[model samples]
Target: MSLGTLGRYELIREIARSNDIVYEAWDPQLDRRVALKELRLPDGISDKDKHARKERFKREARAAGRLEHPNIVSIYEVGEENGRSYIVMEYLEGETLRQRMDREGKITPEDAVKIFDQVLDGLAFAHENGVVHRDIKPENIQLLPDGRVVITDFGIARLQFEPSITVDGQIFGTPSYMSPEQVVGRDVDPRTDVWSCGVVLYEMLSGQKPFTGDTVVTISHRILHAEPAEIDGVPWAIAHVVRKAISKDPDDRYSSAKELKAALNDALQGALTDSMGPPSPWGPPLDPYSAQSPYTYGTSQPPGTGAPSPPPPPGGYAPTGASPYGQPYGASFPPNMPMPPFPPGWVNPPKRPLLSPEASEFLLRTLIVVLIGGVLLATAVGTIAWLDRRSQEATAAKVDQALADEIAKVERLIPSDPLAAQQQLTELRRRAQSHATRERIERLLSRAYLERARRLLDAGTTDETLRQAAGLAQRAAEMAGEDGQATLDAGKLLYDIATRTTDPQDRFDRLTEASKALEVAFNSEGQVRSEAGTLLGNTCLQIALLFGDNKARSSLYLNRGIYYAEQVGNRKLADDLRSRL
Candidate 1:
């Protein structure tokens, strides 16, 4: 059935539906086929909210469209019509890697590396050009019949030159594939994409996510703390490389996609030979999973399960012929190429089944009766559902208003009654929109804790109080999560605690923490940019002072302190640091 037309494009049949609908379309203007994608916003969202989201989406999509990489899907154009926004992209004739993974189960090591190598090359190019693809997964990667691997979806990629469109402290990503820093809402550079690549590569080898849980919270905690299980059917050499690529600490992993690709090539050399041939067009089919499989969703189902029976979020019964990628299987046409026409007479859909006259008559009567009953029942149900929905919405609105008021109050109170504000924010989480608002609330709470602790220190607190205050400040910094203001506040608190601590070990630890936090503040236009630099430099000086007779080490800190102080026109501090030198 025809969906409708947008601009010069005619959206014909819908191939899939999820958070968005992917439609096979004909671009009459270009005389070519395209895939038209449209977004699906949540119900009850405000027009302003919808508009803002669409605008950002258009901007990002347009930017991604400009990318000229062969392996990236080329968005031919983006447009809005009838209050709906869509992108017309070069359509491919293959299936997603997700479908292949489900169909083939785990892939051969050689095929995995082939796909990984191409992906890494494309990503290396993208990163060099300042694009960081934040969302990379089996679902977003596609495979072609000609043995080409293509990366799709730049929906969440950060164009480094552009300011972030997301709100401060608001997190956006698929939970299972998220990097460790991404999970904690920390500052993400291109290294984040490397971590996600490791995850995709692992899934390609093992047919399972290394880190997963029943809920987002559980999964996030695991990504942050747990080591991935060893991949079966692979040598320790391959596993070792995978483990390093997915290291929880970004500092420990390869610095770039190019670096990762080189390492993968080295690992593949010892264990794999050229005889492996091209990868299977698809992976293992879905069936009753073994007791050993980590993923349990739809595992007990027979092969060729039809559309799945309804289940709770992230769990459901697999239906016949559904692709394991959580959507109907089809290749997203490769980027940078015009799509060939669909097979001749593709418009001919499957015919409807026929019924005998007697059976049709009996079915018609039964359907009429059921239709009458269904209408009556629907009326009653609709009334009940409407009332229930209205009541829930009202309650949610009231709670949201209350939460907003609390946020406002906390912002006001944080300057003076911060301890109370911190307590209030902690309590407000009970009413706050759980994952939707949790990050923002956490950052606010971080500021509250930092403020209260700093006030205590400023008022001449005891040694125990200083220690307690420093701990609070540290938690605050963690919760600040790349927000400039919150980081600066927490950084200042850490610096204060570091300066006052007397013990040898405690001072070193506090100074280390202080230096880290203050560096972030110095990088941003934090309320204490110069102050953060001075404190960070001073922390370094304190560490150097411990070296005692090590003049070279002490001189490094003294020089750094003088440079920072001079940066802000603080001659007095610079001179003092120079004296130390």
Candidate 2:
């Protein structure tokens, strides 16, 4: 049977179907061929829920579509009807990494390195665009006939710059390559993608996966506790990259994808011959199914060797979503995170219903108790519940306030004692009581990093150091999110890095990130707004000049920047911005 049309595309045939259906379709509007992905959804959902999901799907699709990189598949459109949603994207002639692995077993180290580099380049670009492919597995990575790799399927991709909150304890991604934090249900960031990439690297280099078990429980246990099996003949630099990328603690991993790729390049170029050492390891070696790592919060292992010294206390980190708790259904508390304030011998809280709907109704219907008795009982119950809620709120407020105070201390120390502030913030994060608190702490810590990056850029003369500073600023920007003061500061720092860097493409990418950050900061006043406007305008001018592909789009940015400069009463900057326009 012929597949029907979805929106304006004629679905020629069903290409594939799993959780979603893919149809090779013709886009009449564009006179082009496109792959249509149809995601199935259950009926009977609330309209609100359905609408929210569709919006999220479209937003993610739009974000992915905006990315223009050689190794990324292009997205065109998204639509939803009835209970199904569809996305139109560029159709490619190639196989997935899973198919390649199945046919060839494992890849050669040389080919693997090249493939890894290409993937990282795409990922680095995506990260720059504030996009994170939460799921980066072999099956999701497509390979072209010419040996070019394209990162596809941004279904679960999240915008890194958007503030995300967790309402339902939910997490996503495949189990086999899940990072340790992912296994335990901790909040994830781009570094989580770094961990998954390490798993891919290991699998490509060695025919077998790093961790395995008979069941999801066992697999999760291994992922949390087991060290990756060593691959013989791995040069020190390659080994170093692998080790650092897969580090159990996110803190131990490279700060950014650019840094990870830099490590790979340094190893490939023999720059690491004089300085190849251990990094964060699969927390001390354990039996593959042991379910526990040797290192604990008290351990003092070397950096990257195992869980390092706990960093400073928590700050203003917060993320909100229905994002899964980083763990699977049966998984337990993740390693490295601070345990809740349970009593020494506390077991699981007893599951008991406080008040079922039936009881309330029965009470209402009971006659004699209805008058004075019902009134008294209802008042008592309501008062008790209110007191309990107020008490809980008060306690949480105190904890959050304390965390805020600690973060303020870190901020004070950033300019004068960055390392100490960093160390202190790291420790505080471990102590942070909730996911939102941890996210806030991460953002505050990134600011401390920004402060250090500024100093390094000011003082350093080495390309490596400059890159490192850029990486730090990126971490700050990614964690602090896409708006307000931190992002603006990060934009300025990235702008500085761009001016200093000589590589044309890298310079362009950095400038692009800078402009994005500055645009978000355009609403502010004083030097920041003026600086952001001028920088954004200049950056846009450079992108348009160098790329020359989308002058119209570039003109949009140039105009906005000029307007921002004019708003700030900076006539000189406004005039300069107009030159770009």
Candidate 3:
């Protein structure tokens, strides 16, 4: 079908194309994209088949449109143009999990858990609204740059939506991830999605599909009767969760995504506690000195020693500057108590040596002579020392000022032209380093390198960019103290690499490094709480996304994001992400 325009949306790109129709299109007018599906009538095909296909498109669009979760990709307007069917949807920028896995092998446990949680959160939302995602697989999941997980192609399985598309008894969905009931064409429920999620998780963790065979017939048989190989090297809790999720009998598996999520959460909590130890205790300790009394003076006894005083004032009369009961000048006594002796070293000043008049006259004469001579010597030496110090200070100050100015310029240019900023920073570093300002120059240079690394990442290809970014970040981290912003930025850069990279092992290592850096940042006390929290959330998200079935880890990412946002006063962003859940 040719859609000249769908509302305000101008067709920008063709997304999905098949022999029967152009399945998806990008729309610009409504700022929303749509799927344009053509209905092709072949010779000998009955009119009933044509009507059924159209009806199926409408049904699927309607069902999927009702879903309202951040992670569930939404379908907007549905209509027909030029005898073809179409449905509009929100535009997405990320590749499918299938593409990612295909490119990078298995996902890390962190990435798996994060992506799985997003899928499950979307599925759970759908199930609560009485909708089931029959085809839940990696291809239907998208990982957005803003760290969002989007589940797509909902309610669009060909057989389920259109009876005429396939025979009733024929199986649908990606064979390896399909549940037994789905393969056998039995009535299914939300557990079907849970089972599919399990398969996806297993594939993510193991880098291989749970059930595989050379023939469809054998694969179907395996789905019906075979047990998947034990998921070795994965967290035991996660393996257990996947096993239950993919159980042959629907009753043996989690009843819903919510149940599966709970189990995952438990596992994540256990893992975090086991790995990080318990949280610190709250509030301050009791003071030990608040109750102590002041020491007495004339009596010569400490207040807390409980020693008896020698006696009261000799005449029972107050001395000069003493109160009526013989308290020291301006002293306030506790009610019902007689004043004690003033403590030693309290009221009286220390005595000084007495000089004879004649000796004092001679000393003054000698002091005047010595002072004049000493002044002359001191002035000469002080002048030279001051000049030398001033020269060094001026040089140091000039280097510092130049470095600071260059750093500011580079920082301002980073978001616009990272390469230019990097070059400029390198020049500034060279200038500073020539002046023997290694520490200061290295820091600025490292920051510039980090910016370049980030830009490289945006340009594409994870490996080279990630490695470069990580190297620069680590250099910055090592040069700067643990709690310094440079170190934190380094950790965050490494984390971005881990999260964006497709390689499971690389992702794991990157995340591990990032986590350690974040820990250092948290412990630094000088680190911004909000930045630390955000990095922690990002780290957890990567970990969970890699792990697959651990919903708790994913939730922790969400929670940490919220916490850090609150700490940093960016609660709106946190709320937006959490709203998807």
Candidate 4:
């Protein structure tokens, strides 16, 4: 059926959805096609709610119209016709990220990082301009055929200057990607969008959502209490960044989208610098500055491949039509020019040669000499560079050996007086000349820090002492630097300190850190894996106790505790915890 026109736009056909029909429409004023979304209220909506929905519909236009970033969808106009609100936007030729994910299952880690980087860029700009995209999901992110990603649907975005239309305790957004605070109807900030970005990145790389449940209630519970399983087949740096971005506590997450983007950039430093390999099978070449046209342009050549081909000749083809002269041949001359008569016995002139044979032979001889000279020069330079590199490596190795010896001496002090050992290792780390030496120093430093923190905790449980111990323990975890045994000891120390904290929030934060470190330790076949598992189980129980009112979350944690307990061969402890269930 023909839907007729709204304002200047002629509705061509319904694109998708009902109730709020998005149509492929034509704009007569600009002679361009656009996407028109009409505001259609549900049949049973209240009058006040209807008015609010209308305002919200128009607000999408207002929100997006203010931003002009390349990754943001362009809004043309918002208007009302016959008491119906409609928005006109540039029609993009591409599928949503959701559709792409459904077809491809998952994106390559490299390409996923690229897409994630762009999404964060767009979100960072939106956040800087005081807009929080509360409902960031794959369905709302558009991936153009040119590999250009655009964020759409700002209908639920919270603008800083505007009064929020949301009723208290009302929740908005997809359950799987909502932040812990967002799932519970708490006040949200830029970090809420950061959480969603993390979920999107995880899904893109892992082919699954980090949090999943059959119902919204169950999903929300998981979001609030459950730790996401580590993503497989990705670099530890990348996985670590993802884990931090999706922390259950907003305060523990990156402060803003910009910060998250920076962290991801660091994690992706090498991948971004290396060749992006083949062009993405998901899209065409990325052409952010191409002119708008109904017809798509460019081949599937990857970005940075080379310049585009030149346009066709003036009339769309080279002058291959009838010639002005008698002979049948292509002509560059204009068709309007009169033909001149040729003199009798006239012959076509021979083409002039650029150089005589004698001159060409001389040029070739000189070129041969220059080529030989160039090769000799390159070889000489390379030999010198190789020798210099060798010398530098030798010097570095000697320095590394000296640093390692110093670290060995400090290792003895760690067992007896860790504070003094930490001071020495910290000083030695500054002069460490290689990655291995630095890593060794860090591992020893972690032990020293953990031992010192343990001593402080034993002295007393005052707030000052607890704070000091927690700080030291956190440093230990950080300095452990991927060493499973060191990380386990630091984690166990942190868990011990966390359980003694008086403040519930403080306890929760510390426990989260302790569990994160322990999780990393437990994954490795380290000496303390069993101890790490037992403490991890206990930490889960503590978190469950904190969520006493929410039985779903509590029960979820209880089950996790029992599972971890069994993994460590503590069947009695597992049974005891299971009885609580």
Best by lDDT: 4
Error of 4 at 451 (Å): 99
Lowest lDDT 10-mer window, candidate 4?
343-352
Count of clashing pairs, candidate 4: 0
Q: What residue runs in model 3 are displaced by over 4 Å at the alpha carbon? A: 1-9, 19-44, 155-170, 275-581
In candidate 2, where is summed lDDT lowest over 10 consecutive residues?
A: 342-351
Instruction: Write candidate 3's Cα lDDT for 547-571 as tens digits.
Output: 4665654554456556555665666
101-148 per-residue lDDT for model 4 (tens digits)? 999997887787788778888988998898888989999899998999
Residue 545 lDDT (model 2): 64
Q: Model 3, 258: alpha-carbon shift in Å? A: 0.6
Each candidate structure's TM-score, on Cα atoms with residue i matched to residue i, is: 0.48, 0.46, 0.44, 0.47
Candidate 2 RMSD to the real structure: 29.9
Q: Each candidate: what lDDT?
A: 0.74, 0.72, 0.66, 0.78
* Candidate 3 TM-score, C-alpha based: 0.44
Candidate 2 — which residues are off by over 4 angstroms?
43-56, 81-84, 163-166, 271-581
* All models, RMSD in angstroms: 26.2, 29.9, 36.3, 26.8
Clashes of 1: 17
